[model samples]
Target: MNQDTPMLPSIEPATLEWREGQPVSARFGDVYFSRENGLEESRYVFLAHNRLPERFANLKAGDTFVVAETGFGTGLNFLATWQAFRDQAPSGARLHFVSVERYPLTSDDLRQALSLWPELESLADELCEQYPPLVVGNHRLVLASGDVRLTLYFGDALEALGELTFEADAWFLDGFAPACNPGLWNTSIIEQIRQHSRPGASLATFTAAGYIRRALADAGFAVQRVPGFGPKRDMIRGDLPPDGQNTGDGNGSILVVGAGIAGSLLARNLADRGRTVIVADRGEAPGTGASGNAQGALYAKLGVQFNDQTRLSLAALLHAQRYYPANTPRVWHGTGLLMMAGSEHERLRQQKFLQQNEYPDRILTPVSAEQARSLTGVPCPHGGLWFPGSGWLEPYRLCTTLLDHPNIRTEFGFRATRLLPCNNRWCLSGEGRQDLIADAVVIAAGHETRKLMPVLGEFRMKAIRGQVTSLPSGALTATPKAVVAGTRYLNPPMNGLAVTGATFDLHDSDPQERLSSHQENIAGLESMIPGLLSCDDLASSVSGRVSFRCTTHDYQPVVGALVNGDGRVLDGAWLFTGLGSKGLMWAPLLAEHLADCLTGQPAALPRSLARRVDPKRCLAEPVDTGVPVG
Candidate 1:
């Protein structure tokens, strides 16, 4: 969809009230949990009825059990299930809890509501800390040091489960009373649950309504009535028999041709999900390519209009902000970011962005010049966009940490020169290195990927050369506490140096840094923040880096599976390049999407957003620089 398409509305925070120290939903006129021992009620209804404890213990090594719920009113059920899974499941097993909520509780309200149960304090604390911004989409949280995963869909329950891609082993048929919220128990919702349920999947609910039982029974579940919790007498339970449908793809060995952000993250994600991942890169270490930026920005650069690219970037930036602290803490912080309006054109663009979209200020806000200066600890020429949840991080360190996983085998110096079919697997080999065969392969070698997979030429991605000038921290009079960007970016100091400039040159593949590029960067910096640096006279000790970045004509990354011109698979090959320059902010979410597409799990992005990064769009769409490229 283009800019003319209406933007997806933001989710409103749940209006809650307290009745006798128990939280009640103001909208539905229902209590979030039973006033009589909510935790016990949760365990008796969802955990016990679904037989989760026994099922958790029965899971094989490396097995991931999925539990889906129609509503996540207070997270009481999820916490109880998590506690049980941890106590009873084997160490090697993982648990994925998927739940939907149209109106999510505010973090403060959630903390206060959950404070009623001290037994679930620890798990509740983590859940509250990792809770997503109340946005109208899915948010994936990797908690318990990656052993437990949660995907919270903040939209209509039916639409969520319809787009969701996963096989649930157990279902928590939850929501308010059928009379209060019939949408959650409608035929469409039942059909989606049945469609996602595994053959032997079991379901339990606190209600035993006849229509609900009949709907589930018609959808292939063997319905039963069970004893309920609290004042309820009878509850519903069911087991779905298989429909003989083949779920595409299996957990298998995968070969990733690049150890850059996209490839490294994708490899590690697949590995964490129980796939054996072999990472092959030509460099002696991770991020030696374009991913080797010393300090990179982690903010979404939205455009003047809410187009597909801007929408995806916003979603990805939010996802990555959550991912870093969840998966790898202390690597980065939300010290925040400032995008200066250095030019009149940019000033108008930033103004238009604010006017066109009604995004929450918690994500981004238009700041005055004084506010920008106050936020960045520098002089600001013009009012710009301020992102409170954005910052910078070392890409090299990120790649290294991601590749240092047991499930991911890193071949640092393996330059994958060829990709062809061998036996039933894809063979990835280079000039002298040993051939590596895997059930699937991901080509993420930036521009060089086109050489390995000739069919990628149809995708029309380009290799652009970029340069970033670095100045020692000691060289600057005062450094911005946060990352600042205009025509060029000035990141907070890393390795005793602050970085700026990145001359975006098309078709130039020079590996050597040029003085002209450094001058251009310094000039841009001078124009953005006049007295921030004395860089014009400080070139004697200046150092910079040059790298070739893969970018599409439209500047969006190409992700997911690649099909040939005739709409056939290209021998199990996947493409994940064209990240342009926002790899740090874009990599995490896009990598998660590729992993989902590969493993047949729930999607990280909606279909329309995902299509913007599809190979077909990157190939077929004409370049329209009508708006600023985010």
Candidate 2:
């Protein structure tokens, strides 16, 4: 699962031309679908040949059917498959569709193309609503009221399939004609397709060329020619032998220690996948740890040097943009954010970060002082990078929502100080609670995670205490339209209060409110925005919260399976903490990853990038996330 990928390219939208109401790809010089019978063509070539209808109907409750596709052109094929699965599959069944697209249709274009079928309008509307920005990365969407999951990779098909980790039961080997877009049908792609296929997995393609059939056979699939749909004469379908076994690696009833963002998200993800999950916390409530901040900004601390940390941060930010809006948008906002130029050091970092990473303006765009003022009502001194889809949210409220799944249970005031093996399961017991038995356990209790490590004097993670003070909006002369951050952050007023300070104190664990911390926050704000806050701000009515963030010595999170002193993963134990101050940004995607590891599903990120956060990453090879773009 190493990600040796090139700098991600901004997706150039597919340009389309209308030919008698049929959409044709300008780049590939191919029709997206047949104007005559595209829907039936999809049903005939993919669903029927792949045996999805019969397979879907046979699925037991809690079963998931995985599908991968080479091209997501117009999404007609996917839509057709989705409808068929819902029609055939059991109520508790799930469909996970993974698709790769080099040139994605703009959301507007997707809507227009889908509008051809009035019957699919409802599902089409939902897809368009959750379609991600044209950024090269994985965009996973939870659709069909959680019955369908779509993980769309907006990148080259071969690279995505090569790096992507999933065992697909079926594959729609689709794209433009091989005569024109043969790269997708090349040996590398065919090999990756076979590599990712599950034993007895079926594949269907629109082409019936002899070489394609030969390649499929050579790749160990039982290949055959089939009658095509509509004007096409023939297609191909293939199945890998059952002996080609590639099995799942995750499972069992799980217990998550910690009710903060990390544990709650992990519990929720597992519960969504039908795993029984119990969340235990020392506090009486969720997010009452590091995630207890009154207001938390949903952004990342991007690096000036593009490294694994930077790549991870960038990926987390992009995934978060789609995740929050789709899952918790009601609890937060994407109004935008401005990281103002603060110190000479910070200004240089911002300039270098922009120059080294040439991302699309939608992800980051620089603004002038005047533009900054226009965007944020009262900003004049400096201008920096503008994160268009970043904002702040109530962290506790988000945690509460994530843990509300039907299959997830919660235990508050459950301090887990001892973990013991019992009958192939794990026993979690500590003060204030009885021993809880779970098939597996994940320690996500912030800094307290270190206390649970079996082979540890100290588990390479430390506590960094932070405090944030909230000032009522009535006390401020001006409020920003968006969140603002530099040395400190300023959130847009919510419920008549605009939140400001967060003193970063290293190696400290005091959880008490302090007047000095309040004064320091106001001082930093006044220094960043000269006239925005009165000097007497400390005297005005203000309240605050203090919490400890758990961070690794290297500052990456401790994710993946919990490893022992000899580097072997402990049986029935996993760790999902060490998010530091970026839990709001990191939890969404990393939680998806840890859940995959714990549940034996495909990983959300490749191991190269994931290794940065892996508990025993130093024992692994060093990560190289390609050169800086531009």
Candidate 3:
């Protein structure tokens, strides 16, 4: 939970030796798998013992089967299980495999290790292509067109597993031998494992150590020692006793207000989980609100040190990068991001931040002025941070694509006037059409959320107006290869055009294009890059758009279940608003969280972070100054 605390040294990549044409780990002094037949050994020890084939086959149309693993050593077990699910499971069922790894192998090393087994080559290649950078966080990978999802936790299992908030239907206890790695089989860890397992969860482990058996038994699992594969005499298999948790009925209709990034994503995620979704917006189409920006940077803006906000931003950034497709031609440009130190004070802050943290270079690399210029082709006056995984996205395109789901029904040119309850369900009524009824309702209407639901008035959502200017690509003598930000941002050329200047005005809701704002943008560019552009060159030809962004007083998004005036959470109403400026980076993961809350599944974010963004947070801790609504 202490995200700011320094991470311990990463796991050293396993050194291997060829023994009888089998891979042997030099560190653990154990074979990666049985020398006689590794693939068959994995299938028998994990799949057969867990009864995954039957479990997967029995899954209903909208059900999700989650499998958690202790170690993801060559990902051999994951690939075999994926293949089994592909062969045996229904098409509508989804497989969510969460694996924790201390030291991850390089892509080249993984390729070589997986090359030993040709049977899993296809799955191995897919995993290799999407393998995340060596960063210490969750990297969610959606494969096979969203049928299979893999969340790889790149850190020590002991620390990483505690951060995860998901209930596993099956567990793959596939770490090293208990005799060699006793830390992994400790009592506390076994208890944590039990905490994250759903009722009647099945578990499989190759080790049959008596200590581990006792640990599993004490942790509430009805464990049993069973026949092992190959030469091994016995393995451990068990099932956790049922724990009372509300598993929602699959057939529920929901209505989502707004069709921007937040609502579109929430609608799609719900639809993916087999819920009928209705997305209502006042615009002619989706992304006509704040998400209609031409080009927005997709990276976390961190402070000098990590805090709750920065930690949440980093998680959201990582999740968006992994969940959304970034190379969909005109949709997203994975050109990386550069944040410049425009002033001496900011330069000192950057230096102090880099000196205090030992982050992986892939996550954030402190670059010198020369390095920044060389990498981005922008002459940043001072050194800054470079985020390799950041990029620029066309929000309108992204939202439209997300709303293209089969289960999503869009109602454009319509706005809801009131939220009324009918027969325990919700009704969304407007002026033109008949009332729309649903089992649940989600309010994602940006700044108009608090206005629509008076109970949320305590959250005090503020509307911040922002304007972005765009110029012809040829206007600049040189273009940055990536998005460069200091006082303002300059995205790389898209469709022979480049965008700049998003001036933040807290109390201004004027949507008209302003020449003064364009001049300010040009000044901003001059400060970051001395000779990029001049006011005279772009003052006459620049085009810009303005939109209002919404945020809460504490700056955390108002997500999760809605709370009534009496402080009880409304059963079928949710709020997913107040994302402010971080919509592109934050929307996807928050959408996942909302979906979890709706489906009675485990949360995707930490509970601490979740509580911070809860809709009732403002009510729980009343602020001295009330929320402002204009």
What TM-score does candidate 3 get on C-alpha atoms? Answer: 0.91
Error of 3 at 444 (Å): 1.3
| Model 1 lDDT tens row, 1-630 | 466433443567788988888889899999888888889998988898889999899877677788999899889899999999999999868888999998888888999988998988999999998887776776878788768888888889988887667889899988899999887888888888988888888999989999999999999999999888879999998997766765434678998999998998898888887789999999999999998988888877776666666768877888898888677665775679998888999888877766666676678788899898889877778878888888888888889998888898988888677788888789987868889989999999998877887453365778888899998787676778988888888987877889997899987978998888888888778778887785457654589999998888777888877666544567578999988888888888898888878877767777667777876655443244232323
Clashing residue pairs found in predicted model 3: none
Candidate 2 C-alpha error for residue 138, in Å: 2.2
As for model 1, its CA RMSD to the true structure in angstroms is 3.9
lDDT of 1 at 619: 47
lDDT of 3 by residue, 1-630 (tens): 266444421224557776766666777898777778778988999999889999889877777788999999888899999999998899788888989887677666678878988988888888887887665566667687667778787777888777878889999998789887787888878988988888989999999999899989988999999999878999999998765774434678999999999999899988877789999998999999999987888877776566656667777887787676632445878788888888888788888777655666667788888988888886667768998888889999988988988899999988778887789899988879778889999999998887777364355569998888887888887878999988888999888878887888888978888888888888787777887863356766788888899988778888888776556777888999999888988898899888877876656766556766877665644433233211
lDDT of each: 0.83, 0.82, 0.81
Q: Please give each candidate's TM-score.
A: 0.93, 0.93, 0.91
Those runs of model 3 whose alpha carbons end farther than 4 Å from true positions after fitting are 1-27, 241-249, 326-330, 454-457, 534-537, 620-630
Q: TM-score-based ranking, best first? A: 1, 2, 3
Candidate 2, residues 35-74: lDDT per residue as tens digits? Answer: 7888988998999999999999998877778999999999
Clashing pairs in 2: 1-607, 2-608, 250-599, 250-600
